[model samples]
Target: MTWNWDQPDWPKFSYKSEALVPLEQQFLLQSGEFVGACKHMGADDQETLKIELISEEAVKTSEIEGKLLNRDSVQSSLRHQLGLGAERPGIDPAERGISEMMVDLYRNFGDSLDDATMFTWHRMLLSGDREIGAIGGYRTHAEPMQVVSGPDYKRSVHFEAPPASRMNDEMTRFIAWFNDTSPGGKTPLPPLTRAGIAHLYFVCIHPFEDGNGRIGRALAEKSLAQNLNRPSLIALAYTIERKRKDYYAALERNNKELEITAWLTYFASTILEAQRNTIARVDFFVAKAKFYETFRDQLNGRQEKVIARMFKEGIDGFKGGLSADNYITIGKTSRATATRDLQDLVEKGALTRTGELRHTRYHLSLAIQSTA
Candidate 1:
C-alpha cells in the first residue's frame, strides 16, 4: 500500500473555499478582540502576559512530543531573551535553545520563510542535544520514516513520509507558497487558515530526523503572527496539548485523502478554541488590574504579597481560599499577626470571610475570578 506522498497528485491539497468562510470570519473577530484587550493593558501587565503566553507555548509544545521541560527554566530563558531580567540562577542549554527558537519566530514573523531560516530553527531546536545523530539540517538517508505505535512485532503505522530524496523540491514549493503574497500570482488564503495548512504540509513532509513536530508548530505560530501583523497573542500549543489525542487523530485521518477539508476544519476549530482561551486570559488580567486599582491604597505589605500570589497562582495558588494557617505560611507572619491581617482585609472589603474560627477562610473579594 502506498502512502499519500506516493500518489500522483501527492502534494496538491484542495478544500472548498466556502467551507472555510465561517471559520475565517470567527478567527478574524476573535483575533481583533484579543488584540484590543492587549492594547488596554498597562505596559507591565502586557509584558507579564506576553512572557506567560510564550513560556506556556514553549513548555506545552515540548509536552506534546512527550518531552517534559522545566517551566521555570523555560520562563527564565524567555525572560532573558525578551530582556525582562531573569530571576533564576542558571538556564539549561536545552531550555535556552527552545526559547531562542520561539523568540526568533516571534521576532521575525514578517520575514519570508526560506530554507536558511528553517535550518537555523532546526539547529536552535536541537542545540544542546548530542544524542540525536542529525541536527541543523535535513535528513540525509532515505530510511523509512513511519510514525508507528505498539511493540516492534505488533506495530501499527499511522503515516509514512516521502523519501529523503524528495525533501528539497517539496520544501522549495512549500516555502515559495508561504512567501508568496502577490494578488495575481496566487490568491492569498486567510492567514489563520493558511497557518493550519502550512502546519499539516510541513509535518507531512517530515523533512527533519528529529523535531519535525515542534518545527511545524512553530511555523504555524509564525504564520499566524504574520497574518495578524503582531507578536504572537495566543498559545495554540496549550490547546493542542490539551486535545493531543484528537489532534493526532485529525492528522492521521486526513493523511490518506486528497481533499483535506476534515483536517482544515479541525485545524480551524482549534484556532477558534485557542482564541477564546486567549480572550478569557485577557479578561482575567483586566479584572486583576481593576481589582488592584480599586484597593491599591488600602492594602498592607503582607496583604499585597498574598493578593499578588493569588493572582499569580490562580486556583492552584490557594485551594479553598486563604485560611489563617495559609496566610501565616504565605505571609511569613505569627498567628496573631496573620489573624489581624485577615480581619483587616475583611474590614477593608479586600477579602470576604467565610466559616468560623479555625475553619474560617479568606477569599479575594475582587469581582474577577481568575481563569489560571
Candidate 2:
C-alpha cells in the first residue's frame, strides 16, 4: 500500500499528455465562449454573477469537507470583502474567513504561488478555527497524516501524506513544479492538464495541517486562470461538489501511482462539465435580465417581491417551485391575493404553473433549465 510519494520517482509525475489534447481544446473553446457570454451580461448581472460564483465556490468547497456554511452569510461576507455591498455586523468567523481567502484568490489569480501566498491563504481560511494546532503553516506534528474513514475501531486508511519532517523540501519542490509548468514557464503545460495535475500534485503533498482540500481546489482554479490570462470564470468546486463521490474515487485511485492519465481525464471531464454549467448560468443571467425587462412594468410590488425571493434561490428557482402558500408568506398577502397574483404571473408568461388545487406549484418560465 505504498503511495506515489513513497516511490523512487517521488514528485516527478508522468501522464499521457496526448490523451488530454481533446479536452484541452474543448476547455479552450468553452472558456472563450464563457468569456464572450459574460460580455453579454448587463453590469448588474455581471456583479451579481461575480458574487454568486465566488460565494458558490466558497460554500461548495466547504461543504465538500463536511462543513455546512450558510450560503447567504458567505455571500454577504464576500460582498463586503469585494466592496460590492455594505458590511453587515455580526458576521460568522468561518464565513468571513473563507470569503477573504476567495476574494484574495480572485483578485490575485495571476500572482506567483509561494510560501507567503500559501500562508496568507491558510491564515485567512482558518482565521477563527481553534481545533487545528498549527495555523498558517505546514503541519509539524510527529504522528502520520492519514486520511481515514469509518469509526475508530474499523477505520480505513485511504491515503497518507508525507511526514511533517519533509514539509520544507516537499513544498519547495511542489512550488517550483507549479511555477515551472505555468503558461510561460520552463515546461509550460496546457490549461486543463496543468490545472488537473496541479490539483492532484498539491493534494498529494498535503502541505497544510488543515484546509488542504480547499487550497488544492483553489490552486486548480488559479492554474486555469493563469493559463487563460484571466479569472477562469468556472465554478469548479460547484461542479465538483455535485460529483463528490466520483471526485474522491478518482483521487483515491490515482494516489498510489504517478502515471495520472485517469485522474487527468476525470479532472478534464469535470472541468468541461464545470464550463458548461457556468455557461448555462451566464445564459440564465442574460435570460433573467430579459425577463425583468419584459415584466418590470407589469408586476405589482407583491409579485415583484415573490419573484426576487425565488431568484435568490439561484438557477433552480425556489426549492419547491413556489407554492401558493409560499407566495402568500413571501408576499405577505392573503390567499386570494396570492392566487390572483400568481395567476397574473402565469397569464403574462412570467411563470409556468403545474399541479392543481392544493397540489399546485408555479415555476419561472426562464429560458434556461437546471444545469443538473
Identify the candidate with maximal TM-score. 2
Task: Choose the strongest candidate by lDDT.
Answer: 2
lDDT of 2 at 27: 90
Clashes of 1: 0
Taking all chains together, the TM-score of candidate 2 against the true structure is: 0.95
Candidate 2 global CA lDDT score = 0.90
Model 2, span 1-372: residue lDDT tens: 899999999877899889999999999888888888888877887988988888888999999999889888998999888887886777788889899999998899998889999998899889899899988899999899989999999999999999999999999998999999998899999999999989998998898889999999999999999999988768899999998999999999999998999999999999999999888888787888889998978999999999999888777677778899999899999999998999899999999999988989999888864353
Give every collision pair in model 2: none
Badly placed stretches (over 4 Å) of model 2 are: 369-372
lDDT by candidate, in order shown: 0.82, 0.90
What is the C-alpha local distance difference test score of candidate 1? 0.82
**Per-candidate alpha-carbon RMSD to the true structure:** 3.4, 1.7
TM-score of 1: 0.86
| Per-residue lDDT over 1-372 for candidate 1, one digit per residue giving the tens place of the 0 to 100 score | 576677789777888868889998988888887877788888889888787788878988999999889888998889889888864777777788789988898788888789988899888888888877778878878688889999999999999998888888989888887777322226566866688788998999999998999999998888888777777667699889989999999999888876888888899889888887777777777777788888878888888888887777642346777788878888999999988888898888878988887788888776543242
